[model samples]
Each structure stands twice: as C-alpha cells, then as structure tokens.
Target chain A: MRVELDVPKCVASGQCVMAAPDVFDQRDDDGVAILLEERPGEELLDDVREAVAVCPAAAIRLVEG
Target chain B: MSDALACPVTGASGPLPEYPLPRAAECPLAPAPAAQELRSEKPITRVRIWNGSTPWLVTRHADQRALLPDPRVSDDDLDPGFPYVNAHRAAIAPVSPRLITNTDAPEHTRLRRTVNGPFVVKRIEKMREPVQKIVDDLIDEMLAGPNPVDLLTAFALPVPSLVIAQLLGVPYEDHDFFQRSSSLVLDGSVPADEARRVSGELAAYLDNLIIQKTADPDDDVLSEMAGRVQAGEMTHTEAVHMGVAMLIAGHETTATMISLGTLALLQHPDQLALLRETDDPKVVANAVDEVLRYLSIVQTGVRRVAKDDIEIGDVVIRKGDGIIFDLHAANWDPEVFPGAQRLDIARPARIHQAFGYGPHQCLGQNLARLELQVVYGTLYRRVPTLRLAAAIEDLEFDHTGTTYGVHGLPVAW
Candidate 1:
C-alpha cells in the first residue's frame, strides 16, 4: 500500500498524527499536516487507513503501489 | 410494544425522558441519571426540550460518531426543528450571521478554512510556554493576595480570557467588559432580551476591533481576519461575529474545566497526586481529556437538525427533524469505556466526544487543550498544598449556563 497526504487540504485536526505519527507531522507555524514519509512500509497500513478515516477535513488519501 | 414503534408522543415513559433531565444530586460528575440509563437502553430516542420541541437525543459513543458526520445531519440552527439549547439561542438563531457555527458543508468549509490557521494542533501547541507563563503569573498573584482565593476568578477564568485576548489583539485590561458580556450571553438564567443586549455589545466591540485590525493590522488572529476582509475572502460582519463566537465559546468552557476539573481532582486525592507528581506531558494531556470526558462540561449537548432522512442503527431521523448529541452520556458510555464511572487519568481517552465529533467538532479545541495542559501541569505542582476550602456538596454548581460548572471554587493551601 502507498499513502499520500494532501497537505493543502489539511485542517490540522491532528487525527493523522495521532493515528500515524511516523508518517505525518504538522508544521509548527500553521499546523498544516506535512508528510514525514511518502511511502511508509506495510506495517503502517492499518494506521494510515485509520488516519484517512478520521481526518475531519478528508485531507489524506491512499494509493496502492 | 417496541419503543421504536411507539407513537411520537410526550410522556415520561415514552422511551425518552424529558430533555435536559436534572443531574442527580448524589451524582455530580456523571451524566444525568436518565441520560446514563437511556444510553444503555435506547441509545437514540426522542426527548422533549424547552419550548416544547422534541429532538432525537443520541447518547451512545459509536452512534454519535456515526451520525455526526452523516451528510443528512446538519449544524444549521435556522431549521425550525433544530433543538435550541434555550429560548435565548432560539431567539438569536434567525439574526445570527452565517458563520462556521451555523453553516454546513460548503459554507462551513469556507469560513472554517479562513479561521483554521490559528487553531490547528501545531499552532496551538506553540502556546504552551506563554500559557505556562500566564498560569505561573496568575498563581503568583492568587497566592500573594488571599488564602481562600476564588479559583474561578483568579486562575481558571483568567487563563483562557487572557490567552484569547492576546490571540485576538483585544486589550487584556478590558477583559472585565468582554468577559462579563460573554458570560451574560451564555448564562441561560439571564433573560433572553438581556442576553441579546449583551450579545449585541460584544459584537459591536468586536466590530470596532476588526476595523482597527483593518487599518492597523497586527500579528494576531483578528489581524489575519481583517486581512481576509481586505482580500474579499469574508465579509466584515462575519469576521466580527466569528470573533464573538470564539470569545464566548473559548471562555467559560475552559474556565469550567479548570475549576470543575480541579474540583474533581480534589475529590480524588490519588488522581490529583498523580497529576501533580507527574512531569510527563502525555500524562497531563491524558488527564485533561479524561477530566473533559468525566465532567463533559458542555451539559446541553451539541444541537443539530437533519437536512434529509437518515437511517442508522434501529432509527431514522426524518428530514427537517432535530438531533441532540448527548455528549456527557456518550463520553461515559460503558461500551466505549469500561469502568466508565471511575476517573482514571491513565486511560487512553483521546477519542472522547467532549469536543464533539466530525466536521463541526470544535473550532477552538486545540487552543483549549493547550491552555488546559499548561494549567494542569503548572497549578498543582506550583502550589503543592492547594486544597478546597469548602466541601464539594456545599459548593454551588452553575447549571444555568451553557457549561456546567461551579459558581466559584474557593481554595486554600
């Protein structure tokens, strides 16, 4: 599985960070979600899905590699 | 004989109790006994509220998570069937500007985007040091003055009031005026007309501030909003009303949390000790969410109406019908929380609905959380011997306001 974060669409609810912190971290200035890893390993798939599910702004998307 | 089939009738035994049921005197920290019971029995049932309107009162955690985000569900208060918290809210609904609080979907998305920059997790997290400084200074002043200090006035109230003022570029010296006006507007016991007048004053004050920010823009949220007005991104009226909303929503809720949360901690010395002794931000953060869940200070619940017929579980909310999410009950739900009655700071409680859920969750929640974390981390540790001056039973709880809290908490160390 491949994951991509739409940083511009992010509202900084931080649900993604809470769900998959290793793959996403918020910028300090505006709190927009920024990608920490473009392609996290398979071990992080469940959490990435959870992060996508919980983002209030629907800012995260997954792409199957 | 199933309650689902029961006629939509008004009666005590009609599956749903009257809305805003009285909290049991013996159970100060739990949801209203009726709400707690209903959470187990009929998670979603119609209940009568003030002004003789009936709305579906959702009590379970999972149900709230499911329906709050449904497209059919809405936050627009202008709907005739929308469950207003009180007559005052109903009175203001029509005249209330189209705001992030009142609009749904595309409009809320737009307004929320304009103001979302300041409240995101990372932005609010930067406030820790300054918020801690404010808490430390307030503690210093409180200690220097009186033994039995009113924590509501001294510490709990000032922290958010000051922080918000700083954020919005309001002079902290005039905190008395805006603070009092905001409180009056939220106080349900106050007459609707009086509340309206106070609300008007708050809006007018913010209007002038927005104008000031327009010409003399500063490094603050209000200034950013003023810039939006200049860019034609939002109307001037909308900006002022948004400021009023932030002040009103941010003020008492955090104040109540501090006083009531401290009150809860004092009742359980072990929990209070755990909070005080720990230097871990994670522990303090969890404690804040636990207290927010355990108390669920926004006692009236998140009010909404259905735009179209929506079905979930065993019920369907018809088009134009009302829905009230019983936040306190959902937070205390036994299914989501084992031993829900016990106050455990160690619980992984980040999922609680104290901030509500979905798109309209809370605009100021991250800011509230940071202010709370700083106070909770600083207060008990600073004044290690702090204790309540009066017994819990003797304190007067303010049930007349939007947030359930004590009128004043007198504490001594």
Candidate 2:
C-alpha cells in the first residue's frame, strides 16, 4: 500500500495524524499534511485506510495492490 | 398518512416534519426520535426549516460522508437556495465577507491555509501541558468556591474562554464581554436585530485587537493572521472576521461539551467510573469521542445548497435545492455504529461527525479534542465524588442555539 497526500488540498484538520501518525505529519508553519512514509509496513495498512476515510479535504489517497 | 395537510404559511401541500424535530424530554442526551426514524424511513428527505423552505435533510452517516465533500454541495450561504439556520443568518449572509465557514474550495482552500497552522495537531499538542494546568486550576477554583455551583459558569465556560483567549492573544480580562457577545451571536432564539448588533460588536472588538497585534507581533494565531495581512495574503477585515469566528466557534461549543458531558457521565455511573479510574490517556480520549457522539450537540444541521444536481440512491437533489445534514442523526446511524444509541465509551467511535465532515470540518477540532481530553481525563479523577446537584428533569436545555446544551449544570463533589 502506498499513501499519497495532496499538500495543497490539505485542510489540516489533522485526522491523518490522529489516525496514522507513523505515516503522516503536519508542517508546523501551514499545518498542511506531510507524508512521513510513502510506503509504510503492512502493519500500518488499517490505520492508513482510516486516514483516507477521515481526511476532511479528501487529500489522502491509498494505492492498494 | 395522506398528503392532506398544507403548510399554512407556504401553502405547500404535504406534512413535512420540521428540520429540527423536538427531542424527547426524558432522553435529553439522545438525538431527536423523529430524526432517527428518518434515517431508516427516508434517508434523504425534505424537512421544513424556519423560512418555510423544505430542504433535504440527510440523516444516514454513510450519505453525509459521501455528500459533504462533493463539489456540488456548497457552503456558500449567499446562494438563494442556501438553508439559513434562521432569519439572522439569512440577514447576515448578504453583508458577510467570505470566510472559511461560508466559501467553497479554491477560495476556502486559500483562506483556510492562512490560518490552519496554529490548529494543526502537532502545534496544538504542544499546548496540552498548559491546557492541563488550566483544567487543574479551574478544578481547584471550583473546589475552593461554593458547593453545588453552576458548573457552566464555574468551570465549563472558563476552560475554553481562557484557552481561546491565550491562543488568539486576546486579553483574558476582556473575556466576560466577548463571551456574552459571542453567545448572543450564536443564540438562534435571540431577535435578529439583537443578534446582528452583538455580532457587529464582536467584529469591531476583534478588528481593534488585530490592529494592536499587527503593530506588536506576538506568538499567537491572531499574530500569525496579522502577519498574513501584512504579506497581502489576507485583508485586515478578513483577519478580524476570522478572529471573531474562532472566538465564537470555539467558546460556547467547548463549554457546552464540558458541562453537558459531565451531566451525561453522572447519569451513567458505570461509564463515569471508567473515566474516573482510567490512567490511560487513550481510554480518556475514546471516552470524549463517545460522549461527543452521544450528545451530538450541534442542533442546527450543517446547511448547504446544491450547486448542481446530486443523485444518490433513488432520490435526485435538484440543482439550487438546499440540504441539511443532521449530525445528531448521522452520529447515531445504526449501520455505521451498531447499537448506535448506546454510549459505550469503549466503542471505536472516532469516525463520528461531531466536529462535522468535509474540507470545512472544524479547524479548531484538534484543539477542541485536546481541551476535551484534558478535561475529561482530569475532572473526573480529581473530584471522584463529583455528581449533579440538580435533577435531570429540572435542568433547562438550550435547543434554540446553534448548539444544544444545558443552560446551567449545578454540580457538587
């Protein structure tokens, strides 16, 4: 699974960080989401999916295989 | 039932249940029973609002999740079809400057970006210790003061007021004035003229504060916004309006949660015990979400106007039609949350739309959660004997406001 964050579309509500802190973080200045890891381990898949589901701006996408 | 009755005012034939159906007096914590029934009977059906307009009320959790982020659904209250919560909102819409609350993307995206930095989880998380101190001190003050005090005035109201004041760099000394003004602005029961007058006062207050913060920069959200105004990213008026918006948005809602959440916990001793006994921050955090889901306090369903026709399931929402997402109903949707009515603190309830859903979701959510987590985590633990001083039936609930909450919550430890 690969996680993609459209930085410009991010509203910075921080659900991604709350859902999958290991995979996403927010920049201190604008609070736009920054991907911590593009391809996290299989263990983090569920959390990543939750992040995609809850991202208010629909900024996060999951590339699943 | 036959479609015999006509709306006396509009002469629209049919019995459309009102958008905000009345909650059962006995079960004050639950969503309106009629609203819950609509989720199963007619997930997307029209309901009459204040202005005699029948807007489609979307009740199901799944439907709200799908529709809120759709481009066709607009937050632009300026649209003719936009369902204003009341006359005041309708009157204010024409003159109001575009802000994060009232604009669609590209515009909303640009405005929201300038202010989101301070509210991001990482930045807000840094305030946990200070917030904890605020909660602790408030509890201490409550302990020292009169017994069986109105918790609304004592603790619940001040926590967010002080925190928001500190965050916005507004003087805490001026909180009494702003708190009263902000509540008046949010109170739907207030006469439109009065609400508008108060709203103007708050805007003026913030406008002056922004001028001060601009000249003498401080480490705060308003200061950051002031800096943006200097950079020409946002206008002076937009910065001021945003300040008023944050204060009005953050103050009463958090206060309501604190006071009302306590009432809920007191009602369920077993759940209250879980919170009181828990040393785990995760447990407390989950408890806050559960209570938030249970209360679903924002009574004015999120209002939007359809920019284009939207089809879902068998129904077609025409372009220029209005839509209202009943958060209480959606939060209690059985498909998303099985045993939906039950307030199980242990339930996986983070998906709840208590802060709402979509790009315009609450910007102060991270901060709100932290404040709640701190309060829910600390208050119960510090005052283990804490219980309601007033009977449940006697307590007055403010149904007319944008958020539904108690007028006064008397408690004693």
Candidate 3:
C-alpha cells in the first residue's frame, strides 16, 4: 500500500498522526502529516485507512499499487 | 398556540417542546432533558423553534452521519425554509453575502477553497510555537496577579483573539471592539436591529483592514486575501466578509472551549488529574477532542434545509424541510459510544461532530485544536492546585447563544 499526503491541502487536524502514528508523523514546524512509511505492510492498513477517513481536509490518499 | 406545539405522540402531554430547549438550571452541563428524551423516543422528531418553524430535530449519531452529508441537504439560509437559529439570523439571511457558513456544496466547495490554504494543518501547526508563547505569557500574567480571576477574560478569550489577530495582521488591542460586535451578532437574546448594527460595524472594520492590506501587504491571511481581490480571483466584499467570518468564528468558539473545557475538567477531578499528569501530546490532544465531544458546545446544532426528499431509518424528510442536528445528543449516543455520558478522556473522540460534519465542517478547526492542545496541556499542569472559586450552580451559563458556555469561570490556586 502506497500512502500519499497532499501537504499543501492538509489542514493538520492530526487525525492521521493519531490514527496511524507509525505510518504518519506531523512535521514539528508546520504540523503537516509526514508519511513515516509510505508503503506499509498489512498490519497497519486498518489504521492507515482510518486516518484517511478522519482527515478534515481530505489530504491523505492511499494508493494500492 | 394551535396544535403546532403539541407532540404528535398519541397520548403525550405539554408542547412538542421548543427546539432550543432550556437546559436544566441544575444540570448545567447535560443537554436539555427534553432533547435527551427525544433522542431516545424519536431520534428524528420535529421541534418548534424561535421563529415558529418546526424543523426535524435529529438526535442520534448514526442519524447525523447518514443525513448531514446527504447531497439532498442544503445550507442556503436565504431559502425561506431554512432552519435559522433565531430571528436575528433569519432577518439577515436575505442580505447576508454567500459565505462558507450559509452556502452548500459546489459553491461551498469553491468558496471554501479560496480560504482553505491558510488553515490547513501545516500552516496552523507552524503557529504552534507562537501560540505556545502566547499561552505561556498569559499564564505568567495570570499567576502574578489576583488569585481568583475569571479565566474567561484573562486566558480563554484573549488567546484566540491574539492568535486570530496575528493571523489577520490586525491589532490585538482592537479585539474588544470586534469581540463585542461578534458577541452581539451571535447572541440570540439581542434584538435583530442591534445585531444588524453590530454586523455593519464589523464589516466596515474589515473593509478598512482590507484596504490597509491592499497597500502594504503582510505575511498574513488578510494580506493573502487582499492579493486575491487584486488578482480578480475574489471580490472586495467577499474578502472582507471572509475576514469577518474567520475572526468571529475562530475567536468565540476557541475562547468558549478553553474557558468551559477547563470548567468541565475541574468538575471531573479524576479526569482532570489524569490530563494534568499526562505529558504526552497524543494524550493531551485526544483529551481535547473528548472534552469537545462531551460538551458538544455548538448547542443549536448544524442547521440545514433538505433540498430533496430523503429517507433514513423510519423517517422520510420531504424536500424544503428544515433539519437541525442536535450535536450533543449525537456525540453522547450510546450505540457508537458505550457509557456515553461518562467523560472518559481515553475514548477515541476524534470523529465527534463538535466541529460539525461534512464539507462545511469548521474551516478554522485545525487552528482551534492546536490552540486548545497548548492551553489544556499547559494550564492544569502549571497551576496544580487550581480549583473553581464558585459552585457550578453559581456560575452564569449563556443558554441563549449559539454555543453553550459560561459567561465567566472564576478560579484560584
């Protein structure tokens, strides 16, 4: 699973960081989501999916490539 | 009073109950008992409101999630059928410019897009250090002065005004004027003409600021908006109104959360102790969301007008009908949240609709969250012995406003 985040569009509500901490960490300065592991194994998919669902700005997108 | 206020139930008593039902004076924190009763008896029940309109009052979480985002929902307040919060809102709807608050999708999408850049997580997060400084400085001043002070005035109100002033490149000193005007506009108890006068003053204030920014652009939201006006991307009036919306929206709600959230924490000592002990930003952040959910401060609920016929559960809402989603009922819903009434800080409260839901969800929410995270994470720890100076009953609560909050929260260490 390839996870992509549109940094510019991200409103940084921190849902992604809260939902999938290992997969997402907010940049300390701007608090925009920084993908920790863009391609994650199956174990983290549930959280990754939840992050995308909760992001207020619709900034996170998961690509199944 | 005709049969309009009568409950449709086959054998019931009293009026159908007012839409903005009075919260029990004793149970200041809980939603109106009538609202809670309606949530259980009929999740989608009709309730008469200020202007004698009977909008469907939705009370369940699942019901709100199903209905708020439905394409059939319309937020255009100008529509004669819109469920306005009060006469003041209804009176202005016809003259009010198209705004993020009143416009529905497509147009809402377009309008929201123009100003969405400034509030995105990245931009708001950048302000964290600055907001931290603001909170810390305020705490120092509060500590140095009187033992018992109204947190509402000293800490809660100013933090947002300063932050928003910084964001807008407006002077923080002028907050008193805008704050008064915004309060008058949002206060349902105020007469319509008075609210209109205040609204005009606010517009004129923003208009003058927009003009200033046009000549000497700064690294701020208003300056960015002025640039848009110059590029013909947005009109002068649109820019001015957006400035007013962001200022008013950001100020009162965040102020309310800080003051009232602290009050809630103080009431729940165990929860307060837990939050105070936790140094983890994650824990603190989650606790903020939980407080927002528990309070569900936007008491009037997210108002909308059904643009097309829609069916959810057993109820069918006809086109042009007004809908009011009672956020408190939905947030405390038992089906999604077990032991919902209990203020469990550890609960996963992120998806709560305190910010409302769907596209029109609060545009300034990210900023509000960060400000709260800083204040909540800091205040309790800084003043370990902090306690409310007055009994909960003694505190004056603003029941007639858009958000349910305390007029003042007197506290001492």
Best by DockQ: 2
Docking class for candidate 3:
incorrect
True contacts kept of each: 0.29, 0.88, 0.12
Candidate models: Cα lDDT each: 0.81, 0.86, 0.81
Calculate DockQ per candidate and list them: 0.39, 0.84, 0.21
| Model 2 RMSD vs true structure | 5.2
- For model 2, fnat equals 0.88
Q: What does each candidate score in C-alpha RMSD?
A: 5.4, 5.2, 5.9
Compute the DockQ of candidate 2.
0.84
lDDT tens digits, residues B38-148, model 3?
777888988888888888989888788777766688888887789988888888889877877788766776666677768756677789998999899989999999989
Q: Residue B285 in candidate 2 has what lDDT?
A: 89
How far is B226's C-alpha from truth in model 2 (Å)?
A: 2.1
TM-score for each model: 0.88, 0.92, 0.85
Query: Which residue pairs show backbone clashes in model 2?
Result: none
Expressed as tens digits, the lDDT of each residue in B7-118 for candidate 1 is: 2211233555777877766566667777877887788999988888789999899898888877688988988889899988999999877877888876776667677777
> TM-score for the first chain of model 1?
0.90
- What tens-digit string does per-residue lDDT give for candidate 2 at A1-65? 77888887788788999999999988887788889999999999999998998898788899975
Alpha-carbon error at B40 in model 3, in Å? 2.3
Native-vs-model 3 lDDT? 0.81
